[model samples]
Target: MADFDKPSSTEEEYFAREDIEKKRKLALQQADQLAAKQREDLRQLHFMKCPKCGMDLHTLKKGHVELDTCFNCKGVWLDAGELEQVLAQGSENNGKVMGAILNLFKRS
Candidate 1:
C-alpha cells in the first residue's frame, strides 16, 4: 500500500520556505502600492494664494464642513460638499477635522 501519512522533513521545510517568501513578496508589493498612493494623493492637494488678497487661503473645519478661508478677503471656499466624505474616511475623531481640512483639494 502507498504511504499517505504526512510530508517528509525536507518537503515540509521547502514548502515552509516557499510560503514565507511568497508572503514576504506580497507584503512588499502592498507597501509599495500604499506609498505610491499616498504620494499621488499629496500631489493632488491644491494650494493657491488668494488672488483678491495677499493672505494665504487656508483650510478650516467647522463641524463637518471644510472651508478655505482668506482672512484678508473674508472669502471662503467649499469643495462641493466634500466635508462629509472626508469625515467618513477618517479613522478617528481626532484627525477628522485636520483630515477634512487637508482633503479640500484631494480628488474624490
Candidate 2:
C-alpha cells in the first residue's frame, strides 16, 4: 500500500525558494521605481532656475517649508503658501527658526 502521509519537504522547499526570489525581484523593481521618481522630482526642482542669474537653486529648510536659494546671485525663492507656512512654524519654534534664518543669511 502507498504511504498516505509522507511529507513533501523537497517540493515545498523548491516552491518556497521560488516565492522568495519572486518577492526579491518585486522589491527590487519597486526600489528602482522609487529612485526614478526621486530623480524626476529633483530634475523638476533643478528646472526652477534662479530668476536673477538663471542658475540652479539649492534647497534651504527652515521651520517647516523648504525655500530655494541661488548660490550664484544670493537670491531666495519662495513658492506660493510656503511663506505663510514658514511664518506659522517660525512662531512655534522661534529660536530654532531664527537660527536657521541666520545660517541662511550667513551663507548668502
Candidate 3:
C-alpha cells in the first residue's frame, strides 16, 4: 500500500519550476528598477553641464530663443528649432542670411 499523503515526484517538479520562474521574474523587475535609477542619476549629474569642459552652462536669451552658453569653453549650444528660428528671422531682411553668416569666417 502506498502513502497517499506524500506528494508525487511530478508534483514536486512542478512546484520547483514555479519557484524558479517566480525568482526569475523578481530578479528581472529588480534589474529594471536599478537601470531606471541609474539613468535618472546620470541625468541629474550631467544636467546643463557643458560637454566640452564639464563646466556649468548659462542661459542667454536672444530674441525668442534661450541659448545655453558655456563661459569657460566659450561654446554656444542651441536647442532644436532655435537655429531655424534665428535664420528665418534674419532671412526676412535678406534671403542670403545663411550665406552671410557663413562668410563671417575667413577662408584658410
What overall lDDT goes with each candidate model?
0.70, 0.82, 0.79
Candidates arranged by lDDT, highest first: 2, 3, 1
Each candidate structure's count of clashing pairs: 0, 0, 0
TM-score: model 1 vs. ground truth:
0.41
Candidate 2 vs candidate 3: which has greater lDDT? 2
The residue ranges of model 2 lying beyond 4 angstroms of the native Cα positions read 1-46
Segments in model 1 whose C-alpha atoms lie over 4 Å from true places: 1-4, 46-108
lDDT of 2 by residue, 1-108 (tens): 355576488978999999999999999999999999999998887687997888988998765688898878788888999878877777788657756775766752
lDDT tens digits, residue span 1-108, model 1: 245676789999999999999999999999999999999886555345665675678877666655677766666565775756555546457676656555554545
* Winner of 1 and 2 under lDDT: 2
> What ordering of candidates by TM-score runs from best to worst?
3, 2, 1
The true-versus-predicted C-alpha distance at residue 71 of model 1, in Å, is 14
Worst-scoring 10-residue span by lDDT in model 2: 99-108
TM-score for every candidate vs. truth?
Answer: 0.41, 0.49, 0.78
lDDT of 3: 0.79
Task: List the candidate 3 regions with Cα displacement exceeding 4 Å.
Answer: 93-108
In model 1, how many backbone clashes occur?
A: 0
The CA lDDT at 5 in model 2 is 70
